[model samples]
Target: MKKKLLVFLLIGVLVFSMAGCGNNAEKPKSDIKVAMVTDEGGVHDQSFNQSAWEGLKKAEKDFGIKVSYVESQQDADFAPNFETLLDAGNDLIWGIGYKLSDALLDAATNNPDQLYAIVDFSYGDKTPDNVVGVVFKAEQSSFLVGYIAGKMTETNKVGFVGGTAGDVIWGFDYGFQAGVQYAAKELGKEIEILNQYAESFSDVSKGKAIATQMYQQGADIIFHASGDTGNGVIEAAKEQDKWAIGVDRDQNYLAPDNVLTSAMKRVDVGVYNVVKDLVEDNFPGGQTVVYGLEEGAVGIAPTSDKHVPKEILEEVKELEKKIIDGEIEVPYNEETFKEFMKTL
Candidate 1:
């Protein structure tokens, strides 16, 4: 009788333990794999691709999920990289640049049920139900940095170096110039703003040459929206003892003294938030998600204090708030910018 009772108790304990284990099962997202196909500049560009990878890494750490990426060496590699990540069973795949728009459309169309994301490109009403577009209001942040350059430039001349000619880069270009124009009017200084486009995001030498020429042309500070090409801009700034404004990331570490400030685009935060939304089963498919100053997705780098004065930093903060509050409207393209120029 005693032995039977002991055996019954043991069985009861085992049943309870099994029930608890079942109740404590992990969420489905734990097993979901995520991957990205980098742009031509690759993950080491220290800008777009790099920030996206950093976001995935943070997602892996926070969610206990696997994350990976495939770097494309050229335009031809884009389609193949997408295929590889998709074949590897990635539950969510991201295309990291506007250049991947065509490839993303094709891939999303072929795999109608497959979940996909693209940064910097939006398909509008034609977007597939399984795809999401992550875009940023880069103009807002560029304007802040441009204001900073306008405040700091002692030479009364500034410049902009760009990688490509597109609506996206246009925002960076016009916003910066508008800010400079605003500051010039305020300070009663006739500031000359120079501009250049290397037509390639990866050509470091061309970027350096542009910066050097701008510096020689009496422009003491220059802002760049070029990816890795901007690295050369910073290098030239350091060598020439001038200032260069970085893009997409806090590039102060590259040249602590020469880097005046960076137009911080939080690509990492954007990617991570999208991953979290997908894991929570709230993936916003067929939508163009715009991250802007209001979303805390873009701003001047925190390292700006290393060079920018307190007064200018405070003004930048106020300007960002005004923009978010609908008081200060930053222009995005040629038409809007022409109008904004009139106001400044």
Candidate 2:
């Protein structure tokens, strides 16, 4: 009887240990998997792609979702990158930037039931039900930056640079011009404004060339809507002993002394919001999600040790308050741009 009882206890221990191992294995299988497709700008461009990646990472932490990504080497590869992630069994796929719009539209059409979200682009009329278009009201923030640059420039001349002249990016350039115009008109000052586009988003040399020319022409402060190319802007600013404003991210850290401020696009917030909705089964589809000053989606970064003037800072703060209160409206699109110009 003693031998039989000892054998029985050993069998119980083995069974209990196996059951514990089974539970541990099952726990990992329950994790949700999310994935992303980056634009040709690539992940480390330190701009839009980087911001989107940061947001997706946040979702992974908040919801315990498994995250993965594929970088697109060029515009031609956008669709392939999207499809590759989808084929890998990603629960939802994110497409970063407007350059991926055509590819996303094509992929959404083919996959019909596939879940995806896009940042910075949209289908004007017929958006896919499974795709969410995340966009931002950059004009609102650009206006504030323009105000600061116009007010702070010692030369009374400011310039704007863009990666390309597309309607999407040009929106930032025009809005910036409007903002500078507004500050100039309101303050009863004649600030010379120069604007140029490099037509290439990744060419640092070209960006630097354009910025140097603008600076030589009397622009003491320059704001750029360029991507990695904007790195060139900072480089040029430092070389020339002038100041440049950054964009999309806190690029002030990139050039501490030369960077005055940055026009933020808040891409990370958009990414986090979309993924959160997806996890909660509240994915907003067939709609354009707009992030603006009111949503805290766009703003100017704080003045660095570069130490912007107190008066300029105060004026910008007041204008920001007015914008948030709906007392001052910023414009989007080309047609409304004319009206925005009148206000400036």
Candidate 3:
């Protein structure tokens, strides 16, 4: 009996050791130490910053690599925050927003040996050899949610609120407009769409103010591409019992009943892909990779089923397939939108 008991104990210890071998927290699985620097919205904004962090965390878990991040309280903190991360000897550093374009560029230029990746910003021809830019087709996701709003709105008046008037935000702006146009045209009726820009991404109060004005103007459904500021739009929707669409991440949890759905941009995938490639020594540096609908980089939140109808979801899938199949080209800006509208 004693001999058998000792053998069982040994077997249990061997099994446990084997199971925990790769994930032994005391011993990192990879030599790559990764880090991230958040935008002014910080790491907890539950949007781009948060999504990017989730991706890095996932990479750290899968590869047993060390990951860390520093939040920027304001625009002035961008350069210094990046400097702090770079000084920490991180093998890879990620910047969470386009607001870090200049600082990231300067860092990459100054330290050509250091590797870097920026989410939501494409450096175009100015891309550095040591850096990679990860961008998404945000317009594709925004248009689907807009279609939902157009079909569901009983008032026939919808609204759009933007964080800033840049090329990035314009994708959300014009895509939503085009979607609403498409739906209204198909319905053989006119749907009034209102638009506004907060000019800042951090001001929640300003977002609320703009959304309140839109709601008072008889618009029932409002979609926002504002970062942290969009929280205010959701709040206004809850207060007025209207519908507000979220962005970047699934924000339905912020106001379950009030938020119709969210346009989910897979920022995590972009962050993870870069880290994974680096770990495998197949790093795609000095390149701009675009993740769009076909790549599963952008789509509506799964939680949409809670509010959006099945037929509408099916319609979204069909339209999404068309977009992915190249049968439908979703516009990214005003000029393209004008040309696209002429085709319809």
Q: TM-score for each prediction?
A: 0.92, 0.88, 0.91
TM-score of 2: 0.88
Ranking by TM-score: 1, 3, 2
Candidate 2 ranges with C-alpha deviation above 4 Å: 1-30, 303-306
Candidate 3 residues 1-344, lDDT tens each? 99999999999999999879856643344667999999878788878889999999999899889999999988899899889988999988898888898899999999999999999898988799899999999999998998899999999999999987988899998888888888988898899999999987888999999999999999999999988888899999999999999999999999999999999999999999998888877789889999999899899998999999999999999999999888878888999899878977
Tens-place lDDT digits, model 2, residues 1-344: 99999999999999999999987755342266788888666778778888889988888888888898898777888877887898898878888878878888888898888888888887756898988899988887888888888777888899988886776686687668777877888779899888888876787898899899999999999999888788898999999999999898888888888999888889999989987887776888887798988798898875533557777777887988988898777665567768876665
How far is 50's C-alpha from truth in model 1 (Å)? Answer: 0.3
Q: For model 1, how does the per-residue alpha-carbon lDDT over 240-272 read when each residue is reduced to its tens digit?
A: 999999999999999999999999889999899
TM-score comparison, 1 vs 3, better candidate:
1
In model 3, the number of clashes is 0
lDDT of 3 at 229: 88
Q: Which model scores highest in lDDT?
A: 1
Worst 10 residues of 3 by lDDT: 22-31
